[model samples]
Target: MAEQKERDRQEDDRSSPLIDQYTARNPEQFARNLARAMEELGKVAAAWTQAREKGEASDVSAAPIADMIKTFSRVSEYWLGDPTRALEAQTRLFAEFMGIWANAIRRMSEAGIPDHAEAPASDKRFQDPEWGRNAFFSFLKQAYLVTSRWALDLVEGADGLDLATRHKARFYMEQVSQALSPSNFLLTNPELFRETMASNGENLVRGMRMLAEDISAGRGDIKLRQSDASQFKVGENIAATPGKVIARNRLVEVLQYAPATENVLKRPLLIVPPWINKFYILDLNPKRSFIRWAVEQGHTVFVISWVNPDERHGTLDWSDYFEEGIRFALNAVEKATGEKQVNAVGYCVGGTLLAASLALMAAEGDERIATATFLTTQVDFTYAGDLKVFVDEEQIAALDKVMQGKGYLDANRMATAFNMLRAGDLIWPYVVNNYLRGKAPLPFDLLYWNSDSTRLAAANHSYYLRNCYLENNLSHGRAVLGGKKIDLGAITIPIFNLAAREDHIAPAKSVFLGSSFFSGPVEFVLAGSGHIAGVVNPPVSNKYQFWTGAKPAGELESWITNAQETGGSWWPYWQTWIEKQDGERVAARKPGGKKKPLGDAPGDYVRIRS
Candidate 1:
């Protein structure tokens, strides 16, 4: 036993060289610091001793009391006199338990378990008392691990110590690194993060969001929607292209996309796309573009393409979109195909514009819209998500001052706002993955498209926020559109409204509110993904699941319940609804047109970025 003790002491002497190197730069200072830490740890030992003495006086098993006292004694000795490896082992065991608790938060969040924003934190946070054992233990373990890693690294290439001591230092260091890893942090706020505006809470939430980006969380196992097609032909194209372009703007380049089939519904179809973005959302990729589906289903499809604004078109506003957009497009479509009336489908902000156009058209006794499909669009904006908290009288005033100098809102600014919304998924995960993990981000097609953002006119954005969202003018029956006093009651068309269950941008409840203004029959659908994915869903993948049952009781609550609960894209279901609305025809028209030449039905605009 005496010889074994001698060997152990000899091994300790060899590792002393690395220990000296680490503390050499400030040996006296480090020793002083270590002494202070030991003094504090000794206090913990004293309390554990008191508890043990009390337990020993009783008939109960004092084993738990004895163990805790030993742990505190071990920690106190290491920081002061001994500085051995055994203390670190106990610290690590305690830390593993806390880490298991931290990761549990994310699992709970993904499962939609509501957080206790109002719940008080555990009494373990009372650090001045013995109750703080949990917090104190966690802090101690974390520090121990950090020291262990550096100590291990120090001994890795050293010449002196036996293999076991070197291994002890190395193992502790690795264990410390794992304990201090950034992944161990929780990625959430008190749920109040969503309600925060210009406060540091927003910053905290943004920081958490940045940490929880899609990449950091690991690639989602959910499949993406895909489709396969062998040929492309509008049934009417067999003989000649039957679609017509009523209007074409060299200045705006807003091509009107409309098709002519064998038996057109008594009324034609007109589309309104948001100017903040180009109109191609209705005509995205071939297999899933709403316009492509519309054409194949035998309906006349017309889409408006907005000219991407640069330094030149920056001055454009609400009037230009009305007179030159809807009015011009309407006349052109009417003259080209000679249709007396047409139905309209508007998406996002475009639907708001469509609301104005319909109100004005109705006021003028020029009611032509037979039915309208507002896909994830909103006319009422009492609660426009986090977008509301960011832009109000003050923020808009500042933005207006900046935009006035440039003549329009920079597209990059719009991108920045959206980036703030999903900062976790869209922005920061890559930062951790790159700087800390030493890896590049995975290339995701949706992220690529999201990164491809566009600018909107300053006048339009300012007007849109103040009049539409902040003031809630459209829904209040207190706005004007195209020289007509606006009244939503004037909109008398069959309404098909849609939104998504998980859409952070346009929550389904808000979208469902639009039904209140309309006296006509209304149908609302809530899809299963976020904003973009839910809208562009395709049946090729079961990634999307939809509900299509009874109509919602109140557009909001019913929206949550009424979804018939179908899996995959809602595209096929939408097509079926369209076909059912119109009578059937035996033959489809030929593929050509007069003075039109069937020049690319969707046109080249759909192929370009905003």
Candidate 2:
């Protein structure tokens, strides 16, 4: 209770601000932004001139220039060619709001009472007491949101635009609409106004300091989180599950988590996490830690903690990740456990790699995997959700140029792209709280983990995006990794496919498509949450639910119709499934017999931050 009070005080103190201060400084800030943008543009122009003068303006450079111009032209024509269209949309929106108001007033007069309408569950802007208890502001808030929605639809409905182009436009439109909402401003938000008055402008001073720090940190474009580096540390309090790094290679570190039970399964469980982020996501905390839970469930669990890549690691491709990363860990696990067969689990891109590895192993007639579990993994890229908008020939070419310069994709660049996918939730909220309301960021373990992202090697990133996102080769059995063509249908092992219903990266439907390629029995489960929460769900929380069905081979719609709802975590169900696949129970063994314990569970690789 005392800690809660302290947090509340921090929030109130942080949130005190003024519309006056913002309005007063708006002109100066705009001028500064404009000047910096012009300076950057001038630098680019100078570089282009220097390149041409030095005879370095080859066809490669010229092609990107030409393509960029073409894209600009097409986009300009789509939105700017019909200037009257946007104005007409605004007019129509005003007319609709007026009509709504008139109808509401007439109904109230006839009924001789107030007629209140419920707000949409997704819209929290009008949830404030000022908007809900006050009928006038309530109607105004609804009208504003309705107009915002209509404006977005108008932009998205532009004719002759590609799906990718449409999505990109809508994304920006939503950002602007969300930012300009009345709830974000101090003058409009009654609660914020009250706090500002009470604090007597100290929040504004603190907010300015916060803005300056962000500018210093080179993340002024968007304030993603409020917490500083001092807020949390890894391995001590956060990723502190008991384990040992039993094996290590250049590409991966194999973490053998200490068994939490007296008796363990015959087959060990190997986890393949995505190389895009640190592996501690699975071992986040004891309560929500999936690795700790798996160990407690009587499984000899091991996970691969991928190396945070730098320029030197740029040449490493998908094959290196397969052979040196997953395969190396697999070999070490087999040597240590004396178990030929294993239960493999993969999450996100790691899941994709696992599926590919299993297929390649299957092709070699090496059936070492007894059961394969995929969490939010996509073998088929068709309908890959919002991420598809950023993948295309032109986008890939531009990204290549950036990667070639740096030898790897910047961590911030990748983080920004993912944040853009859910701008309303991830991007704009921080913008309002940090910039407008002048509030310090709340300390969230998940957000801290999110901010602690890793870099991707240039060649590895390029190959994965081109082959998986653009060509759709993996699902079609045409993607060649480690000099072998991987066929998903080749793996006939019992599969447990888990997908987040609201996953933006790997849509549930796209994940379900993998089941169609498998010949063996599949138990498809759909968990109720987004990407991270669905996978990290622990039964002790009893929060998010999951749905399971036997008809994994059927269409996604049919499976949903036939699926049964379970009111707890999907971990126990997975435990039972893996138990059936395991050989016989044996006494729990300690880590590192065949291979010596390298260090602690997370290892040195995970500690290397970009």
Candidate 3:
């Protein structure tokens, strides 16, 4: 109760400026708002006695709305007066009052109720239909309609309105972005979501993707880790979950939680971290930590911990990522495990780099690599999922402008971009709760983690877009890497491929396309989830599903023909294939030959930040 009081106080404090804003500078605008408030107060008074006079077509029929208006009287009283003194006060007060009503509408919308989708709240078609429609009172509708009209007037630069009203309108539309506001209509409707999905009718795909993500989140059983400091010390072991980086020369070090047994066991494996976020997505917690599971399973696991890039790293490109990212990590893993013939597992962008490494190695005839696995990784970007539509000329140009200002893509900018892709799910749900219900949005683990993002080097992004996505060079069995032409056909070693059934960034079929270009025997598995969750899937969390073919599920058509559907995570299936290929449990020892680390395991280049 005390904490709630404190929070309420803080919110009031934050809202105070908005209340006092127009009082001093804008008087004319205040009058319009003052009239609206008086008008609402009059309606409320009538609604209380008249509208509720039995048979007055009551909107306050709902227990919730009745309770809401009973409180609104008290809440609005602070703002509702003669509409005479300091008209600016009236304007500011009305704007703030409207904020409350807007929030209320939003809360009601989040029930996924269809009646809320349209205005005037009649002719209802929500899941609850009859039960939900009659909930709102005609009197409350009158109050809301009047205030909303005032808001529209304020927004349109209406004359005779006080400086505060006009300022509120002009200010919020461009700068305030009532996007998260309880009353925001943008998120509640299917318009925004429909626009994106309209391109491919990816409704089923999106549903599958979200289902997989939920499964992954369930595994994490993840607890929110909040802090004001970046570097945190816990039990003498430093774990860095730096949610974001604002300054230069900083990083979020996701802990590599391998079990004690993996400390010495053979078959060194370096887990490829995706470029989209911190590596902790894979090693979320003890229950969901793939690293912990792999180590417990007796494989010496080492993960590539990437430095959060900044403006200084803007010029870094694909060549730099290979030399310093995968190559550098491989060198360190070799030294740690004392084995040059280690396995490699690539994920998303990291998987692409692994594939690039294979070609780079195959070109040089370096076969220290024993086996390779690509989880939801794509080399061919022709059908690059939902993300492809975003790469259209106009959108990319807008992105270039946005990126130009920072030289490096800002992490939050990326977060916002992706959030727009699922605006209804990620943004609107909270808007409704916080605004209409005077409630707090759900602090979902996935949403919280989704907020954590990382920047990609401008040059690296350019290389990826042009060489891989645009040119399709990586899929043609020909692409240059490490000063030599990389040929996928040259890699005769065992290869494992898994693509997410619901992946939007890189469609499963598109990812499987690479297997067609490879000469080696290929095993492709289609996992049950989307991009991230599909790869991070663990065993304890069953109930998810996957698909695999007797041979390879390469190309959309053939894979569609031969695919065999399965009903559990592909993790166990992968373990069987991996076990068959991995021979001789050579005790884990540090490499002594050319694989020796130049200095320490983490290395200087990786540690290198802005």
Candidate 4:
């Protein structure tokens, strides 16, 4: 035992030298860097103040902080109102802490003891080797995990709260826990501490400067930079697919890509992407460009580039989107290709619009669209994911008033909400990297496209929230559009519905549930990964797998249990499905058949950053 103690002392001595190698060696330099960081922080504060004066920062009244507090109070009432229950909750937490303390003590007495509490393997925040190797960090990590789980369990076990209130409480709790993570702070995070010590606090100086610049860019708010924005441009490298704008309208520009094959399908493909984001997500680059691949697969593709709406478009509602957006594109495709019937594709909210438009077409005896494809789209919001937390009547009313004042919801507002959905992945990591660790994120095309947000018009956004999310009208055959009641059963067109297994924006279960609403035979395919990667997966990458099985009948889990997994990208599978619908071919047509070309593909509207 004495020899073992000597060996342990030697190990500690060896580690001390190694740690000293990264410690601040020059006090003068460290002082200078600290002073510079302070100056940068001052600038950050000033920029925020200036933004507030200019009304560029977030409006306090418009924020949901109050709503969060109100919901949390209800949770508090559940726990605190009952002495026994409060004691039980406290006792449970105390017991967990005691267990963790016992484990820590055991770890000290015996070197090989495992952690009492461990983060999931997939959690990147706790991936640093020091988090496990260092006793202090390990204990801190376990304590945090235990507390966070306990807080969440309290919300789950709480009574007297409606589903909406409970959901809000849970989401709010997650956000708070994520924000307060030890990994977010330099002192608690071993990696950040080491980085700061090694660089003599220079990292913090750089980080503060970047923070000030980002705040200024956000007009007094911190517009977190998720990627190196300098490395990407719209037409230059990112959305550089060869195509031309064959038609233009107030709401959309119909971009028809140049043919990449000798022969093309008879029916031109029209894609109605969500107006909440640019159409370039489908055409990020040639490597990941779904549009380019489809064009190469002997199909003429036309995509709608929605205008970044300002106050001028505030009054535009779903009808305008249907008529001027979808209907206009269908008319343009007919003029461009001389084909009245075309295959249609819609992504996310775009799919929702397409589903409604198809119903309207059925009612009007218009059969322009031959088939429909929905990508991570939700027609039924019954099982919609975390996004539902934001859609109660009270919140919607408040949002409506805010939109009325500004004519549209700001891009940052929408971006923030989306970021909050995965705050652990999206928000906190960026906060630590950009502000705490003082590092710029690597250039990523997907993140770049994600950062390029679009504004939501008041009337249109309000109608969508109230109808789709709040009321779930589209699925119930109660949705009234353009003074006509929409019936999903009336539209019997063949439908290809795709859902990502790990998609948060649109859950797989929700998509499966939605598939049942369509009267037509729906070919439901489940792809691996989240909303973006799952849909944009190309054949060459050979990354994730996709699953196919019996029609989307019964529960999602049951269907998945009976499903067959296909390796590689779902792109080829989708191509085969497309061909199954219509295999007739014709000579490949140029950008514009009859209509004149306005400009290059990825049109002018997409270039307009909000």
Collision count for each candidate, in order: 30, 1, 22, 0
Better of 1 and 2 by lDDT: 2
Best by lDDT, which number?
A: 4
Q: Model 4 TM-score? A: 0.95
Cα lDDT of model 1 by residue, 52-92, tens digit? 46431121113323433443343344444434554555465
User: Tens-digit lDDT track for model 4 on 426-513?
Assistant: 8899999999788899999999999999989999999999889999999999998889999998889999999999998999999999
Instruction: Give the whole-model CA lDDT for all candidates, comma-separated.
Output: 0.54, 0.76, 0.54, 0.89
List TM-scores for all candidates, in order.
0.59, 0.83, 0.59, 0.95
lDDT ranking, best first: 4, 2, 3, 1
Ranking by TM-score: 4, 2, 3, 1
Which residues of candidate 2, in runs, are more than 4 Å off? 1-91, 100-122, 131-143, 155-166, 185-194, 218-223, 226-229
RMSD from true fold, candidate 3: 18.9
Mark the regions of model 3 whose C-alpha exceeds 4 Å error after superposition.
Answer: 1-132, 135-258, 262-265, 401-405, 434-444, 477-479, 553-562, 587-610
Give model 2 RMSD, 1 decimal.
6.4
Candidate 4: count of backbone clashes, pairs at least 3 residues apart or interchain? 0
